[model samples]
Target: MSQSAPYALPFHHHGKSKVRVGRVWREGNVHHMVEWNVNTMIDSDMEHAFIKGENTGMTATDTQKNTVYVVAQRMSQRCTVEQFAIALAQHFVRTYPLVSKAKIYVEQKPWARVQQGGLPHDHGYALQGTEVRTVYVTYDKAGKLDVTAGIKELSVLKTTQSGYEGFLRDQYTLLPEVNDRIMASTVTSTWKYTSQPPCYDAAFNAARGALLEGFLGPAKGGIYSPSVQFTLYDMAKILLDRVPQAESVFLNMPNLHFLPCAPVGSTFKNDVYVATSEPHGNIEAVVTRRTAAPHVSKL
Candidate 1:
């Protein structure tokens, strides 16, 4: 039933995408919830499905979608998104002999417990802003596994103690140098772990805190940001110093501009500015220990 062709199938993977699920755990009156958008890809030896039009060994995409819900349901204990992703990935490789490897990507929406009269409500939750926690897990039949966790769309800003100056200028350069200006960015950070930490949530908190602290510095006098590039490096370095389990950290921070502006009758001052999102500077870097292997981001 097979026909030979000049082309060869060297790499093939198939699965489902955007399988959304919400899981909640309850302890007496207290409750916790996680809403994840999951995507799964399975690499398998199913060349026959392509070359010979065979469907016998192929796993349906619907089945893959159902597996995500099934795996989430089977998780009896509360677990981090990384743990859930790893479990779902391992399930495909172990359950299907044809599957050589499985990769899972999960994005968790931020939902903070609502406060009622200075106390957190037991079951009430409010949707936090655009920020989301993300994880990518890969598992192979040979036991090789990789996990990368990240934070996305985290918007931050500072009113002062930032500047850009003394850059190579050419005829095309029209921007002027300033000693003090507003710095803002929507940060996307990812860290790869050398080994699973005892508590993923704690590790995440440490990394996030480090990023914020590095950017804003102390309350008395904030740190001076020479440029976005300098701030990106500082944030990554701080994250590595705080997260021992993380072998490396990758940060993508776009320098969103807040242009100083004033009405025709009023003079321009630092207090008045116009916020802008597009036409921004893109800066990214990866910081890792010298001894650690070169870190690759799969997210």
Candidate 2:
């Protein structure tokens, strides 16, 4: 009888530790800064490293760390996270013959331009809120490129134009329906562009603008969301409608509750609320247009 296959399929990927890099650029006192934590993976036919402990195909993680700094300095043109992502992916895929594909994920820390004396301050900046921008890029030997951009920890609240009702209220459901109530969510969204946009900066800005507009625009003139489920769909639809370059969008918005508590005796005001962060409702979905192909890759 034929011998059984030696183990299952071999492990196909290796290389690179997490590399964190910070870059600050100054052009005639106008300062721009970005802090990024990057992780890279190289996929190749390197089962030898796993099966026989032959590590010849491995690229040192230390070298990967050094490469981040070097690439950041060599960048002469204005560098956005998306642009830097492409640069990183291309460098790894082209430099290493053994690397059949490269995957790079970059997280950008938020820093806002400081405003002083009513005008934007030159050479001054402050760390903004925890809102972070993330980018992911994949490059393959066949020249296929996939890029995804996202926002995280973006807090938004609207006192009007949002409501919730018409839910299946069983005995366990204690929440009451409200026509007008405080709606708040920490918005986390990601969009995969149709290939790379002509202008990465423009596409990013437009997509972000669509999100804000969908959330904050007038109910009469814009989207009147009856619930977070409705609002999430509208947000994705607006982005896809407004930005032609984006092929698909994903959104995860957790419902932050501001439950109404009854006023105490005769002095406690009913307007005051206790904001609870944990044990909130998590809603997420992906919106995409009908594609000609049966399957589409995700980021």
Candidate 3:
């Protein structure tokens, strides 16, 4: 008979980091700026921390935050969110030998230059809407990369050319079907880039335009939609058609409700309605080419 001795398993694993960096590059008093909330995660194959209580190969989260700002400083001209995230992820894989993978996400808040005297101000700026621009990047030591860009909390509404019908009816079906109604949603969408584009900023702009166009364009609105599922498909399809570099597109639209209301005591009828944000319908779907494949294996 043989007895096996107890052995330690590797355990130093994940590192979570955040960076809030305000970048400004001035070109003769005309300044371009972006505020970013960057998050990075490092996944390693160190299991010794759990079994042996060792913390030697762990990378500090503070170090990751510093790396983000340092990389941004060097990239004043090419300071797109996607570019910064790629640089950050590459840094982790190259700098830390023990780290096997890095996932980086960057969110760029909307800020437009303030207008004064019928002109845009050079230094002054104002916070605009809730629409947020975001990027996610992943890098592996094995020479793999994945990049995704997205928009969040983009409130959209089309008064007409939207409806809900042709649904399964049952005892629980108290809601009535309508041929026309208000369509409102807080859109959250993400699209994975097949390959890194020449200019991430340009790609983002073009993709966003396609999404909005498909949602409310005259040509898109000309066709009738029976449900949000159809609209979601159209939105995603348009994005893929417009952005050739994109491999896939995803959309999550929560159907905000607008119940028709009429004055109780008066015989007057108004076109107004009560809008409800919660307890509403939800529709989500993803569109991609049948032959399209991920650049990197899932981590």
Q: For each candidate, give its TM-score against the true structure.
A: 0.96, 0.90, 0.90
Per-residue lDDT over 1-299 for candidate 2, one digit per residue giving the tens place of the 0 to 100 score: 12474676445765565687878888887877778888877787676676677878677677777788888887876689988988888888888788789888888888778899899988777899877888888898988998888888888888666788999999899888877777889998888877677887788778888888878776564445699988888888899887787778889899998876565765424476677888999998888877812122222
Task: Kindly provide the TM-score of model 1 when superposed on the true structure, using C-alpha atoms.
Answer: 0.96
Instruction: Give the count of colliding residue pairs in each prediction.
Output: 0, 0, 8
Model 3 scores a TM of: 0.90
Name the top TM-score candidate: 1
By TM-score, is 1 or 3 better?
A: 1
Candidate 2, residue 167: Cα displacement in angstroms equals 1.1
lDDT of 2: 0.79
- Give candidate 1 misplaced runs (Cα > 4 Å): 1-5
| After superposition, candidate 2 runs with Cα above 4 Å error | 1-6, 15-18, 219-223, 266-270, 292-299
Per-residue accuracy of model 1 over 1-299 as CA lDDT, tens digit each: 33465677788899898899999999889998889999999999888898778887777889999999999988889999999999999999999989999999899999889999999999999999888899989999999999889999998899999999999899999999999999999999899999988999999999889999889998889999999999898998889899988888888899999999996899997788988999999988888877876566655
Q: What is the Cα-based lDDT of residue 131 in candidate 3?
A: 92
Q: Each candidate's lDDT (Cα)?
A: 0.90, 0.79, 0.82
Stretches off by above 4 angstroms in model 3 are 1-12, 219-223, 266-270, 294-299
